[model samples]
Structures are given as structure tokens and as C-alpha cells.
Target: MNAPWKSGSSGGRDQFAAYLCDDAAMDVLRPIVADLGWQPEKCCRGGLRNAVQSLSVTASPNILLVDLSESGDPLSDINALAEVCEPGTIVIAIGQVNDVRLYRDLVASGIHDYLLKPLSPVQVRDALTHAQAVYSAPRSHDAAGAKPHVSTAVIGTRGGVGTSTLATSLAWLFSADYKLPTALLDLDIHFGTGALCLDLEPGRGLTDAIENPSRIDGLFIERAMIRANDNLAILSAEAPISTPLMTDGSAFLQLAEEFRQAFEMTVIDMPRNMLINFPQLAAEVNVAVIVTEMTLASARDAIRMLSWFRAHAPQTRVLVVANKVQSALAEISKGDFEASIEAGIHLSIPYDLKASSLAAKLGQTFVDANRATKAGAAIRDLARLIAETGEAQADSTAKPSLLGKIDFKAMMPRTRKKAQAGG
Candidate 1:
């Protein structure tokens, strides 16, 4: 199926920018460039002099690949790009010299990647694809001063129902798929597996973070987390069977609030028994993902939880997800499950014993096991759906009001004012 995120029917052209000055390189890369998902209008080809001149007037591109082999003066090309390339533009330089010095220099100057080319379309596509992937990985600083973060609480109806698994998977997918920073907090004080799930054994995440929640900032949180992958970061204690930790709801809120300040997405895997205080949490959350099973008791409890949110936190979006769905005939169907809970099944992750076992044994998410698995693909789709739907909802709510202008720059850097004419 085609990705729903791709906008259509607006006659909007899909474009990307590429620069190739060498005739030989252009011949080899033209087809490859086409395959990289960019149009001719999105690409600009010229010698070093012409390309540099056009840089000031050209629109910023999502991806830029320049053949530095033909351009003897790489500095000039780099300078031109640095001035006009957008904040997150991905640039790859193809060079003749395989010298480490040149590669290091370009990378240090903020070029995403460098490739030594005799030139193949596959190679160009691969390099550009990788650069786009890396460049799109969201940085922690983006949310530093932007709007408040969205905190999602992923709680399981039963203990062994894989709350930590679901939470970590969702967090990792959010960070990896949407290219947004995500933080997963294991709220289970006595027995939390968030650290184990991501194969991270940090000193003390929640324990240390809660001790002096007042000092929780981006730096502090960064030091507390264990970097799991390119996008996902885990925050929790070291050992699963560790000693008791002192953490009250106030401390939790304080840490969560800081997480909100630092990360684009924050997910708290609240303990199932802690649902007694669901109202309190629902009021503060932007969304709550409730993971349940086919069992009747679990369904009943999920229904109650849904009703609780509907009655109390009407503004919060509650998503019901069925985890470890064994078979089509085991119990309730999708329609019945939704009817029972009175909330649609936002996501249904099929049972993948091999993937789940490997992840559990190695303390990794299924998506990390192998990106091509059924579970991995489903999680990617789920993440994309969540992100797009949220964006659509936000767009719908954003309308020009009585005020002459609307500030659509929610989480972007402030624009510098034009200098006064004679001041």
C-alpha cells in the first residue's frame, strides 16, 4: 500500500535537489537520481562556479548530492550550501580523492556524507538514502524551547501482557519513524524492564532523576538515558531486580515535565495496578495507549478505563491496542473488541513468537530485531498513522482567529528581524 502521508490531488510536485558538474558523473547518476525520488526541477546541475551562483536563489532541498571530484574548490561549494541550505538539509559530496583528510574536512564542515565515485546509480541512491535517514533523525535540541511535549502512557491490562515491550516498541518507533526524539519512562518502581527492554543498564534513571527533580534538564536527562539506536533513548534504572526506589507522583510529574521540555515524544509505562489513579494521569496526558488482551477480564477492565477517560479527560485521545493477538479464532473479533471497549482498536500487533522471543531474550524491541519482520512493519505503519493523524488534527484546529496574524511557528527557531534602515 502507498504511504498515506504523501499528499496528493493538490498538483504539488515531489522534488529533491542534486548538483552534478561532471559530464561523466551526470550520465551515470541521471537515472539513479530519478530513482531517488526527485524530479528534474528539484535538481540543479552546473560547474562549481554556476552552482555556487545559483545557491543563493535556489530553494532549499531535502537532499543535496554534489560531485566534489569535478569541483576543485570544494570550499566554495560548501560555503554556498551552508548559507542557503535549510536547517535539516542533507548534503552528500562525491569526490575523486579517497583521502581521509578531504572526507574528514567535508564532514567537519557539516556535510552529511562523502562518497568516492567512479559512479553507479545504486551507489548514489544508497548514499543519498542513508544521508536522508541520518539527517532526518531528530535532535534533542529541536524540542528544547518549543511547545510542550506529548506524554503517552502505555499501560497493560495484565503484568505479563508486555507493557514494557509495547512502551519501548512504541517509543522507538516514534523516534525512528517520525524522526522525533522519544523518551520511555518505566514507571514500575519495584519491577521495571524498560532498561532491559532496550538492553540499557543505566546507573539510575527514574531513581536518580526523582531524587532531585528540580535539577532535571536536558543535560541531566541526556546523562541519565542509554542511547538505544539512532532515534530512541531509554530512561530507567540499571537492574530489573534492583532495590526499591523513592518516587512519588509529584517527582514523577516533575521528571515527566522536564522530559516534556526536552523530547518530542514521552511515553510512561505506568503499572497496571496504578490504574486506580488513571483520572489523575489522564488529565495530564495528551494521549493514553491502553494495551489489552482477548481475555474477558482484561476487556472488562479496558472498558472501564475507556469510560473513565471519556468521563474525566475528554480532551485526551485514548487509543485501545490489542497486544499478542494469537489467532483470528481464539476469542473476540476486532469488531466485538471495539464494541466491548467502546473505543476502536487503534492498532493490532500480530503475534510474532520468533521476533518477540529474540527481543525479550536480548532485551530489544521487535522492530530492532529485523526491520522487515511482520511485527516491525506493523509498528512502522502504526507510528506513521499516529504521527499523520495527529498532524491532521492539529492542522484542523489551527485557524486564523480575530488576531490579525497567527503564529504557526510552534517549535521552530525565531526569525531574526530585518535590520532597521538607518538605525
Candidate 2:
């Protein structure tokens, strides 16, 4: 079990609280609460809904035991409770049902443990003791050198530059190839394709976090993010266009903080406007990947974005990737574009329209669908560059890469010149 999921930092709140719908449950729970040195009077004569109402106004306790016996839709109501509860609260759901599937689902949703009602003092005590241990582990882990985290914010200089494509591919490579647990956070709100690129349905995770920033924690993150694989999970949304995006960007920052503790790498497909509206969102970002095309608009916007990063987030590494490169069709030459931005191009992916279509038709990432193509190879090189940035940060003498270098910078911008250079 993930100890972070059991994260229980009791920030000035009660040590434990319970809302039971029945009197018998309370009679059994009170004695155990007193034994643990928690205030037994904290247990009230209500169910999950009451806990939601009370916690919405006050800080959540270190450990919570909520009665789900009364909830008509326990899973849905659990999500509702998540909206009100603060992070670092270990939740234990008590219900009358004894289905193995239900127990697994509840634990997966961040509950420390689910106790079937007819609550035995011994079973409850043992569960609480284990939850208490889990609650105390993260603080010690932090003291003993927290795991290194890498965060790359992928931004499009202009729309339709395949920014989401590049972002999703990088996340997939980190998880699938490198075997690092990764998260892809698509901040496009109304028009994100981070989940779609992976053939996943965008869940309510991102929107839920936006609506209830306080609810975000290891458990909320585990439940909210739709898993793409064993190692990769994504938080994205297809919010209604009619309903405008609302938030001060605090939720995104909080989500990123939790991710730093939970996963090894996080790739954020952040749109240009969001970055401009909330510059502080990049404060935790380790690298800023500027995805663009060989267009005059892309060059102009990339310059503006480069200057913004230099001014606002100088600590973050900047990588310029020119995507969908078609030398003959390009409005501006790569040399001219680089000159315009005052930065060198880190990687330029040649356009392969057929391979791209094949990826979409099969519902796979570009690199995965067409690994033999130039574009796919270029994307892999980009992934390596981004992955190594974190390694370099953790130790000056990072582990040597097994991959032979692919010199993306040596490839020429013009097709004929590139052919001649290669020959």
C-alpha cells in the first residue's frame, strides 16, 4: 500500500473524528478513541454527510472514520467527502457491506482501510494503529531525503503545434520506457487532449481539484487521476465551454506539490494563456518545454515566451522543440526562428502526416505508433533530454545513459541540406 495515500498530518485539527449513523457503532468506537488518546466525544451521531458539512467549515482531523452505511451511492458520496476534507487525513470507511470488490475499491480511493460494520474493537484498534503508523511515515521520509521529483511544463507557442502530442509522448516514454511512475497534467481545461492522446476518457480529477483545492492529497490524487498504465496516470478535463474556467491557479500549484511527493515525474501540458495568467505555476517546474512549429507566429510567440521564462522562472531549464517540421512549407527558416527567439533549437521533429494519422486512428502516441519514423526517433531523443535533466539535478555525476546519442542539433533545417549533411 502507498504510505503517502495514508498520509495523515494533523495540522492543529483533532487527532481523530467519526460520524456514525447508529448508536451501537459509537458505543464500540468511543472506548478505542480514548485508548488512543483521541477525544472520543469527537464521534458524533451522524454519517458521512455530517462529516462533510463539519469539515467544510473546519480543518479535517488527522484520521477520520466515516459511516458509509447510509450513503445511497457510497462511491459518489466518497468523492463528495473528498471535496470537503483536507489533505493528510487518513479516511477509514465503515459500512455494512462485506464485498471484497468494495473493500478494494475503497482502499484504491484513498481510504486507509474499510471496516465492515458490527465493528469489533480489536479489528478497529489494529486498523487504527496501522493507519497511525502510515500517518507518521512521510514526515520521517522527508527528513531522510525525500525522493527526487522532476516536473516539465510543456507549453505551445501557438495552438496546433502538437504541444499536447509532445507532452503526452514524453509522459508515456517516462513511464513505459524508463519505468518511472509519471503523471501528465493537462491544463488546457476546455480543449485538452492529454487523456485523449492516450485513448483515455478525461475524468473529473482536474475539475474536482479545481473546485476543491483543500481535498487534494495523496489519496485524492490517486483516486482522481485516470490511470493510463501501471506507471502513468493523467489529470485532465474536457470542461464545458459555456462554463468559464474559474480558479486563482492555486489548485494547480497544490496538485503539483502533491505530485512531487507522489510520483517520480510530472509532465504538464500547459497552454500559453494559463502560464501568463498564473506565472507562479511554474515555480515548482524543473523544466519548461516550449513546443512550436516553423511558422512566423510560432517564432514570435516563442520569443515572447522565452523572455517571460527568463524573467519569471529563470531557475527552470528551457528547451525549445520545433514540432511538425516541414522544411519546404515552413514560413520561417529554423535559423531565422532561432535568431528571432535568441535560443538554439534543442530538437526539430520532421513532419510525418501518415504516421500521425496512424497514431490517431489506432489511439496511440505518435512515437509508440510509428517508432521507426524520423519523427518518432526525434521524440525519443527529446524524451531522453528531458529525463536526464532530473538525473543531472539529483547528482552532478548522474548515472550514465545506456542510449547512444542521437544528434538532433546536427540535422539541418532544409531537407536538401539535411540530406547532403547526412550523406
Give each model's whole-structure lDDT: 0.61, 0.77
lDDT of 2 by residue, 1-423 (tens): 111122235557787889999998999999999999989899997799888777766777777889998888887777767766656667777888655445434533555556766888876887677567657664633414756778898999998999999999999999999999999999999999998999999989999988876567679998999998999999999999998987755577668867877799999999999766666566557888999999888888998999888876676889999998999999999888888888999999998999989999999988889899999999999999988777565443222211111111110010111111111
Which parts of model 2 are misplaced by more than 4 Å?
1-137, 143-145, 394-423
Per-residue lDDT of model 1, residues 1-423, tens digit only: 111132222133223566776677777767776676566554556744554455455444565666675676686557655654444456666767655435434533555556666776655665566555544555543424355456778878776776777788878888876678788888776678787777777557667765665445557877877787776777776444555444334356446645766677887888865555323344456677788887777788898878776775565667777778876654777778778877788778777788888887877676777578876776666666656555443334333221111111111111001110111
* Model number with the top lDDT: 2
Which pairs of residues have clashing backbones in candidate 1? none
- Give the lowest summed-lDDT range of ten residues in model 2: 406-415
TM for every model, in the order presented, reads: 0.55, 0.62
Models, CA RMSD each: 20.3, 17.4
Candidate 2 accuracy as lDDT: 0.77
